[model samples]
Target: MKDAQKPDHVSLNTLIMRLREGQFVIPDFQREFEWKPWDIKELMRSIFLDYYIGSLLLWKGKQENFNALSCERIYGYPKGNGNPVHIVLDGQQRLTAMYYAFLAPDVNLPNRANRALYFVHVDKFMAEEYDDAFNYDWLTRRWSKIIDNPEVQYEQHIFPLAIMGAGGWELPNWVQGYEQFWKNRTQEAEEAGDADAIEMAAKSTENAHLFGEHLKGITEQYQVAYIELDQDLAVDKVCDIFTQINSKGIRLDAFDLINALLKPKGLQLKHMWRAAASRLEFVETEKMNVYILQVMSILRQSYCSPKYLYFLLPGQEKPVRDPDGTRRKEVLITDAQDFEGRWHNAVDALQAAIKLLQHPHEFAAISSKYLPYVSILPVFASIQAHIKTIQASQRLDAQRKARHWYWASVFTNRYSGSVESTSARDFMDMKAWLQDDNAEPPLITEFKTRFKTLEFRKETKRGTSVYNGLFNLLVLMGARDWMSGNVTLADDLDDHHIVPKKWGAEHLQGKVIDTILNRTPLSAETNRHVISDRLPNQYLPDLIAENGEAAVRSILESHCISPAALAILLRDPFTAEDFEEFIAERQRTFQEAIETLLVKERLDLPVQLRELDEQIEQIELGLRKVIVAVLQADSQYELPSHILRNVKERIQRAAKKNAALDGDYYDTLEGKMEFCDLRELHDAIKTKALWPQFQPRFVNKETLNIKFGQLAELRNAIRHSRSADEITRKEGEAAILWFAKVLK
Candidate 1:
């Protein structure tokens, strides 16, 4: 195609006039509206001093045509009647400022009138007659001339508006004063009716003409470049011109501008992501912007361009036009949608995976080398999706399976250095393995089988080998949350030596001190005050004081350390038998807990699926209820009768089907009431909706009863009154509790 023609060079007046008319529109994807008042002022000053600014670059593409500019895209453009003419993009900030100044009446322009006009002081001009005659008061907006005679006070002031008529020119302060001086002499003679009056009029007219001529000369000498683009010009060409001409002498990064070009179409998606990011910030206030951006970039598969990820979403990429001219350029609508959907799914999976990693005890032991890979959420989402497809109880299996795959993938990809690839082929292979039913080694099953082999078994002075193993597990689990912050090393923190570190020489049998089995996690602060060697009488009291009596009791019951064992410990202080027994029991419990947690996490699939389904149903039901309520209002209240009737019918049917039953069921085999009517319908609905698919597998009834009481209070508030204030408070409280449970 022939290159689009550039605009003929035009004068400032012509350019300003064209701008005043509505022939131009700024593309919505242009960079954020940014121009300080002083910046506008400086531009005006430069124009006033230099007479011309510079040229503008433009592009001419069809409105809907999708094409890549040289790596530097300016902004997104809407389809136009003819081919789109993009501002190749010089003078964007300048033209935008001018456009706003002329068109937007409410725009807060400095000085109120002619924001483009700047003042020069009378002191700038010095001439014998002009010096004494001219008086310029900028603050009061007046220009005046003083009569020569000291006794007579005759003020002759010139207003800027009067001096600059329709086709006007600016005059220097000196010329303005000289013109006023001649006019004053003319007026004096005219009043006195002397020969001088006629003489002064001629002098005054000549002087005024001379001043006008000088102003016109200055206006003619000033110039600026104006480049117009034809409808077919590419944006990259303009950006190159901009890079060459920009006074800063620095070139714009090509990728940055290309990213900008994609922005407009991505606004909706950006807003959605931002909203989610905002919620993350709400949960944790520090450096959330950075985290959100990092998360977004990884999910979008453009982490390398972290700053521009928001703009260059895959969904925003434009399609290239065919060189053969057989097909016109058009948006790849389906491709964009698919890309966005996949990205969103990845985000969802990552969010689910992080919930498991947030546990302080479990996550603290994870390693940092695999942090970044594990943190990538898209990988997690793909794994989750694959696992769900293969597992019969997918919804319940999704989170746990997702967690497993997350860690497994991290281990394979990051630690082994065998799985990481920009092509994602390796990750995809793993995903396929998990999804395949007939595969010889099912991905999850194989992962479990290898986990034992890969598991760290060597003990170190730092801590157990299990810590290293768990670190690797965290990466595979897609635990980005654990990636942040420093780990609480057992040495740095209070980790009790279950068999005291300071065992007597006789009891130790010359064994080295830093045994892994002897230590267990404890609060650092509590460890110091508790002391290493406790006297016989003080041991039980010291343990109780620090860990609480209940913890001590549990420890005593679980370990079953006999009186004889205690007596031996009192005598020798660090007997091998006690240490052996305690370490063995503690390690077993620890291993069992982790194993059970993993299994329970995976097994709880059905419950979570049901809960999610129930939640969706409840939301639909609530919306229906709202519609019914609106319809049931009296016709006099401005509701249409037919609509109301339809809504009422739907609600009535829903109510009859036990929509209001709140998912609570009571058994009554005989003629007896089996459940209390405590108005807990709303609580029941929320509980049913929120309850996790995987139970902890160890429920404390007392804790459950306490939670039930809190639920009862909330139910009472909902049932007793629907007042706006009461409803809002109850809703807020319920939301807080619900979120707390999720975090727990």
Candidate 2:
């Protein structure tokens, strides 16, 4: 039996060629294709990263063996004579994934509704972001066209993997075409004198060449190992060998290996887990087992990757780095007792963190499904443990800071990619913040800047972090059951539609009717009996009749629906326009609630600066109305010739530099005013012709110019995202009052 012998290697290019030619075949006994799309993406990523993807076991098939075993072509392979040379014994899943990705056959994945296609993001690949470089999409008509269109592919910086499997000069030709496409674009940008576009296109051209070389390297050099059994070997012997290989129990992960490694050191890692399992059972994720180890590593060395996790073993030295990276040392784990202590501490901390997540008064992730990011739990638990160790008076403040961090992380999708490094960095940043409140992490500021513009309408899916986090927010808001009028119990709540799905489907055509703006937490019973298949205008009156309007309004307020939104819902005509108004009003209410409860001090600006900022906004509004009215008072609504020549030309030049102003610049006079800075508005007013129209309101251009200058200084401070000094605020306040009186 030469069954267990030395393995030979085949390059990926050769393997793909063999697959296309139907040289490799699967025996009838092999399992059907079972890999998921994400699994296929990971395989592609590994191949690109040049990581070992294990080996294949094959039986060298003769005519007699092929006839006896009833060999079949791989799924999605064209049916033909096939002229099979080998029958696969192992690695069916990997080989099939490669075939599905590279070949991109016209078939849906197993048990999936839509056909899938794989792509490589050339920009991400060139940046060495292997995890995010590979992606797949449903083969809809739109995606099909996108993959086939070379211009669209170049614009998006993605490369179709199927070209590689097309087998001849197709890949190299496509790569060359991509490089030339960007080179031409760079030339066009240069001709247009757009420095930014020129830089972008030139960088894309360089990346194209780099990505092409990388792809060529992977295809021609990446190897797959395989062991072949002789054709002369009997079928019974081959069948027995396959059974022994496939009958293995559970596949080992890092945790299992670590458990065994700890046993010889007198640490029963498995026994500790058995003891702690009951406490963590409420989390309902298998990953909780390894998260314990990850948390331990994070608390010890501020890193939880596999390489750092190994340092937790007894007598293993963990390299410690100073903040400045100037000092470093290896600190050994003292003993098994020390390991056990860390394990227990991690367990306790994780328990506390889970309780906080499920607590209605805390982060309010009601259940596993409602948890915005399970991947963030390890760092979260470590932070919670640190909070407990602080002084009693400071613990509340520390917990509040932690809560802000959690919400910011959830909303920003901070843990979605490169989780290990992100977790470590956040842990370090948060630890610093907890000790010194002035050193807030960057995510809190990011959340504040983006919170107002968050597109709640796009959050239509239930399982995404933003969707689940919004639901959790409703639960935390103390959403009440309509019929029962009690606080919503976590386990009993469902994200039910405020506007019944049936009514919305009929009336809200072309609108995203299932957005979070239209959904809120309600008990299953309330959703079924109270609000079933009825509009809010229809069911809300019934609720008000049962409970008084005041109580019902209070209940609605708990769901972040303000009195204004309630009025919109209770409109008599209640057309689709009212529904849209209700959605907008409720979104505004949610923004207010989020600002008050979570992002209390986004910029941490002083109260005086905020009031001054609002004053400046009011002054600007007055100026815009006066300018537009003066311009439109005669025959047509237009800027005066001199003002247009000076102010409009300058604003248009600024628009070219700031892309955000392009749309406004091309619009009407009012739209152009929206893009105008305070100084530009002052320029228009101080123009010789326009000064006659404004002098009556302002009394004189000299005072107008001085007050406008003060307002401009204050506006500049606010726009540049900095606080005005006390002297500037005093002068700006005087100018605000002066303008308000004059405009009046």
Candidate 3:
């Protein structure tokens, strides 16, 4: 059933000789050579030991469907061609490694272009035992002085693996010169009075002769095994045989196949894609292939995806990429010649789309790092390319529509599935909206209102789409630092909590700290030094005393707080009861701020916003009682000093684990430790294993430990700048009710 015959044997010299003369070619379907230096070293070692590495699989074909360029690509290759070119279907990695190690002394890998061609010296190393076998340990791709040693002679010490064919250079092997070097080394060692060196030199002399003879036999006589498939086979059949026999498990990629297809037609994939992509500096070559294909599809069929680049069109009766096969439009370009002008426009449109995102600076909230969705770019570019010139009046309307789509897409997790499908639909939708005069964008308000999932989650970075959207929204509304006067920059901003996590953890079990309602963007420098886990209730007034109330309130309103909400939160000795009310009130303002983008209404922020000072006073007294109970349960004498000392130890331990979590309390131990707030005392106490001390009195150790862990986790979420909005909502009320039970 098979067209190919049994395996055949060919000398390494003969094989390379054929390769250099363009007699051998690598098929486009094969993966790029991926052997590292270790692999090369091992392969050479096996060959020197005369072990059977493997046979090369050659597909002898009448003609290639792809490029003939592949035929001329053997390293150290001569320009002339033989009658037929054999495609090496297998053993490419091993063959490439051999070439990199022994031959191709001038070729360099792309990254290390300045380096000399790879080599390994046989008789180069001298300090150790004189063995005929070359050490394959330092198998570096780059050249070194050791590999280029003057003592090494061709077919003797330094072996050349690549030079082959009629036109190749051959360096003569010197037998007498190798003997003279060892004799000279022996004389020098004798004069130095080193017996070991003398003995090694004499041994090197004998081994050099043996090694040289062995190298000569291998290069001149030994054969490298190979199998050549029948030339009468079809391209697809050859491909199937190649794939079935390939040991390296490299799958066929679209680009390689496409290049092969284009090569016969005198078109190069790299040249065509590069000419268009170099105009735009941001996208890389591999991605450019995708862009070009998408553009060509849009130009030809007006329906495209990056997947189109690899699809076998015009050749295959039905080329497939998408699970749902891409439907070719009736207007598809029948030939490649008709496709160029359209591809150029697609390139220009892609560039224009990037510019459109940057034009008014409002959209600059996204950078390459936090793009949220990359497919959005090319799809948007394609849509904008089809449209007429925009009127100035229509720009605002266009922006509103774009924003609605952006926010809705992010919050609703629209593109989490099939991006090409989503992009196709979105592109069509935008095209429809851009054409219609009476088009109204989807109500962002409805999306936000239906969004029950808008809760804070702890994350190391702000790369998520939701985080990106929220940051852009805050930037849209002028967010500023409460402590400093400077406008906040996201790069320098910290998502800071308003109510100190430490105090909330103590009184309210530290729940609700990571909520977007609690977290506001403040300058990192101000947040680090000013807010430092101290509640706004206490810190705001302290700041107001130093800097006037007007200065502080201005910054709060910019964070989307109403003046009334700010006043309620700013109350002195703000308690856990007041903390609950403050979070509830602040959440409402946040909602109103989001709604402003859609409806654009002013909220009537009443100045007499309820401040529960009496309830706050009662909560503070109750908290002091709880602290006194916790401390006195184990120790009754000099309770204030005992509490202070215990809290100091807890602060020192937490500061050790992560100094950032300490809120700069590490800088001044006496200041942080001496007569701090009840909340601070609670945080310090919670850090220690104190439930055993309170065992059988208030709660058991297990219950106390669980309660303490939940509270600590709440503080941890804030300390790490993670989301705890759900914790705040879930645990805030329960903690307050538990405290209410404890107080009763």
Candidate 4:
């Protein structure tokens, strides 16, 4: 489109008067409400000082062929028609100030110009002047108090115009001279019956020079480039123009211009925002912009950015009905009722999301992008509006419901790829396919095929195995055997080595290898103890006792048979195949438990499950910190300074190590290794005391039954166990809760 033509410069008075006529409206997406009262006063002062403030920018546009112009009420509202004749593209601040100044009941008097503007009664400046004295009383010929007592030492307070007209006038002498001059001029006009003389006397008495000089200054200096756009110009185009021009020193936020266009449509973007803001009262508005962005993210699911809203409805004129009976497209604002209902729905959904967040375990899988999407609430609400129930099973069958849930996840996950890219499109298409009515069977078939092919066992060197292997194992062995096996590879089992590996000369002499058979599972407690002292003999007794003969024999046949017999297993080098089989079995067990645990924990639903992970991580981290603190404190007693320092350093290192893992090691060797840090061990000792309410029972140290000191020894034994006992669900929960309490 060709560039719109510019308009000629106009006077400040004309601009101000035009603005008062409702010549414009600030859009809802425009910048935040930021004009202070003082800024308004300053603009007025400049106008009153005759400073050229600038001209308003006007846009000529059509809404359904009706001629319309964009403008603003620089001075609140006009006395007559409310139609804004002048739309301000620039100089909004100055115009806004002028508009507000006239509406304001109280006028801030300038310090230097105080005596000069004294056309009213001298008493108006006297001690404790009433508000009535300062206002112009039009009925009275002169100011009310001044007319009542014209000769009450008026020259001392009033600034006579005759002296003002004369250059280099001394204030004291000119005051006396102007009083005499006004007296003569008044008498001459009355006696001669000359209208000119009467006008001069009145004008001179009112100190017109002060008002004139102020107006002159405003008209001469302040310059505004007022560009008037043709009706064809779109709101987005205008925004682009505004941004380009203002990009130099001062610039408008993209949303600000968007708001200006959105405001008059009665979209109530600001009101919606305010409502959201109210809900987040705990966070300040300035700090809540992210939250606001999040809301917008939800509102416009297709477009993550709020700025895109402007492009959606691009024009100066309001969207209205066509006169020729033609159909008109509707924007979000077109259906105010529907929009509001949807908005409220979004708000309600957001409230639920926040509640879910309180249990971080539920939101652990949620991405930052997803966070903003959920914050929007509208998208969720709309999908929910169509649903019979938001429950997981019901939603699975509801296509509309599923789509919303899927998109929420997609947007929330941020997809880790560009939305505009082919990859993203494919993903979306796949998601849609999954939700399609006719394609449901094919989708289910594809899922089954994928699930069957999924490797439950995959071996990786120096890292935790995937859950698939673990899940398969859990299913094959059955829950009872899995929970009570020799070596106790159960709830809190950590992946361990059947043969101890160390970073020493002995291992260096042999072939370095990565094998699964060398790996066995131990509980977190046993793993910690074994990590410090890498010897299989120390843990053998515990393993045999916990698992019994059959479990031990099974483990040996599956993992330790390659190198002659089970006794020679630890002495021989581990083969790659041995490692692969062990990892594969573990992965199978892990996969089975993933969904099982989710169900057991009542977090089987998608949303709830996502949240559960976050909560669990938070609880775990909190516990670790508390343990570290106690360990640090405990090190201070009896130990030599060097030994204490060494322990503290190790504890710090362990905490740091755990942090890097991002809380993924719940039942892993690495997790146990972290607990081995003395600081963590110390925290375990203090956990009972720190959380007395939860651990109310006092342990008798003498009897070695649940005492703080005795527990400390138990922690040591668990850490050192070569073959750890199986961890029960209750024990796992207690450990997690204890950590959370300590952190709190």
Cα lDDT of model 4 by residue, 1-744, tens digit: 565654454555445445445565543324433565545444543433333344445565444212232332333344445674434555565555444443321233233221111232333422224332232222233443543443433533442222222223233354454456566777888899998888867655554333334334443433333556675777777666656655753433333343443455566566576767666443223424333333333344433333333324423122233778353444543344554555565566555544443222433212221132333233333333334334555453454324333323332233333332322233334335445543332222232223334443223343222221232232223222223444343345444554455632244334232333345444556556634445444454456687675666565443323223444333334444434444454445433333333212223334333343445545445544544454455554232344345545554544443343334552333344343444443444344444332233223223312322333333333322222234432343454455444445
Better of 2 and 4 by TM-score: 2
Candidate 3 clashes between residue pairs 3 or more apart in a chain or in different chains: 66-260, 102-161, 103-162, 457-723, 458-723, 505-510, 511-728, 512-728
Writing each residue's lDDT as its tens digit, candidate 3 over 21-116 gives 456656666777666555666676666544546567776755654253244344433345354467777777876666555555355543443433
Candidate 4 similarity to native, TM-score: 0.29
Which segments of model 2 are wrong by more than 4 Å? 1-251, 319-332, 509-511, 601-744
How does residue 106 of candidate 1 score in lDDT? 27
lDDT of 2 at 363: 72
Q: Which ten residues in a row have the lowest lDDT in candidate 2?
A: 600-609
Q: Over all chains combined, what TM-score does candidate 3 have?
A: 0.41
Residue pairs with backbone atoms closer than 3 Å in model 2 (clashes): none
C-alpha local distance difference test of each model: 0.40, 0.81, 0.55, 0.41
Cα lDDT tens digits, model 2, 426-448, are 89998898888657776776787
For candidate 4, the 10 contiguous residues with the lowest summed lDDT are 111-120
Task: Go through the candidates in order and give the C-alpha RMSD of each one to the true structure.
Answer: 30.5, 12.9, 22.3, 27.7
Per-prediction count of colliding residue pairs? Answer: 20, 0, 8, 85
Arranged by lDDT with the best first, the candidates are 2, 3, 4, 1
Candidate 4 wrong stretches, greater than 4 Å: 1-308, 311-327, 334-344, 351-414, 420-578, 588-744
Error of 1 at 322 (Å): 21
